[model samples]
Target: MVSRILNATVIGIISGIVLGAVLKVIEEQTTKKVYTLLLNIDFIPILNSIQFGEMGEFLFHLLFSIILSFIYMSWTEKSSPNSALAYFVKASIVTFPTILLYFPLSFLALKEVPAINDIQSIMFWTFGHFMYVIALSVLVYLQQKKPRS
Candidate 1:
C-alpha cells in the first residue's frame, strides 16, 4: 500500500509538472495571458511575492496538479479497467471543476472577483485543466494495460 501510494505521488507530481508545462506553452502560443492564478497568492503570508513574484505561481500550479493527480490516480487504481470512453467520461466529470476550485481560491486570496474574467480566459483554463485530466487518464490506462511486475 505504501509503495502504491508513493508511486502514485511520483506520477502525480509528474502529471502536475506536465500540466504546468502545457499551460506555459499555451500562454506562449496565445496572445492573451491565461495564467493569472498566481496573481492571487497574496493570501499566503509566507509566499508573498515569492521568488520575485514568479515561483509562487509555479509552485501553486504544480502543487495543485500533484494533489488532483494523486487523488485521481489512487481512485483509478481501485476502479476496474473500464473502456477508454467510460474513463474519459469519468475524468471529465471529475476534472471539470478546475475553474470552480480556482475561482474561490483566488477570491479568498485576492478579495476580488477571480476566474472567468472573459470567455478567452475561461477557455484557456478549461483547456489546460481538461487536458491535464486527459493526460492522467491516458497514463493510468497505459499502466493498467501493462503486465504486473
Candidate 2:
C-alpha cells in the first residue's frame, strides 16, 4: 500500500508538471490564460481571497493531480488494461469529466480568467486536458511494465 501510494505520487507529479508546463507555454505564446485557469481557485470561497503565487497555485494543482493519480492507480489495478489504446481509452474515460471544469471555473472565478463561453479558451482547455490524458496514460503504462533480464 505504501509503495503504491508512493508510485502514484511520483507519477502524478511528473504528469502534472508536464501538463502544467505545456499549458503555461501555450498561454504564454498565445496570451490565452489557460495556465492561469488551470490554477484558479477563486470558486473556493475563503480560499479564493488569499493570493497564491504561481508556485503556490501550481502546488495546489499538483495536489489534485496526486489525488487523481491515486484514483487512477487503484482503478487500473482492478482491470489492468494491456494495450496502449486500452490505456488511452481508460484514461480518457476517467479524465473526460475534468475537461468540463472550464465552464464552472470560468463562471465562478473572480480573477481574470477566460469567459465561460469563450470558444477559443474552451478549445485550449480541452486540448490541454487531452494532453494530460495522454501523459497519464503513457505514465501509467510505463509504470505497469515489468522489468526483465
Candidate 3:
C-alpha cells in the first residue's frame, strides 16, 4: 500500500508538471491564457484571499493531480487494466469531465483567465488535459509493468 501510494504520487507529480509546462508554453506562445486557467484558484473561497504566485498556484494544481492519481490508481487496481491502451482509455474516461471544467473555472475565476466561451482556449485546455492523461497512462503503465522486488 505504501509503495502504491508512492508510485501514484510520483505519477501525479510528473503528469501535473507535464501538463502545467505544456499549457504554460502554449499560453506564452499563443496568448490563450489556458495555463492561467489551469492555475486559477479564485473559486476556492479562502484560498483566493491571497496570491500564491505561479509556483504556489502550481502546487495547488499538483495537489489535485496527486489526489486524482490516487483515485485513478486505486480504480486501476480494482479493474486490473492489462495493456497500455487500456490504461490510456481508463485515464481518459476518468479525466474527461475535467475538460469541461474550463467552463466553470473561467466563470468563477476572479483573476485573469480565459473566458468561459473562448473556443480557442477551450481547445487548448482540452488538448492539455489529453496530454496529462497520456502522461498518467504512460507512467502508470510503466510502473505496473515493473516486477515487484
Please tell me which predicted candidate would have the highest TM-score against the true structure: 3
Candidate 1 per-residue C-alpha lDDT over 63-111 given as tens digits, one digit per residue, 9 for 90 to 100: 7666776677666777875787766766676677775665555556553
lDDT for each candidate structure: 0.64, 0.87, 0.91
**Clashing residue pairs found in predicted model 2:** none
Candidate 1: Cα lDDT at 82: 77
Candidate topping lDDT: 3
Q: Write the per-residue lDDT of candidate 3 for residues 1-149, one digit (tens) a residue.
A: 88888988999999999999999999999999999999988789788898789899999899899998888888888898989999999999888888988999999888789888889998999999999999999998888888878
lDDT of 2 by residue, 14-59 (tens): 8789889888988999899889999998789788888888999999
Off by over 4 Å in 2: none
Using TM-score as the measure, name the better of candidate 1 and candidate 3: 3
Better of 1 and 2 by TM-score: 2
TM-score for candidate 2, please give it: 0.94
Give all TM-scores, in the order shown.
0.76, 0.94, 0.96
In candidate 1, where is summed lDDT lowest over 10 consecutive residues? 109-118
Off by over 4 Å in 1: 38-40, 49-53, 105-115
Give the Å error, residue 137, model 1. Answer: 0.4
Candidate 3, number of clashes: 0
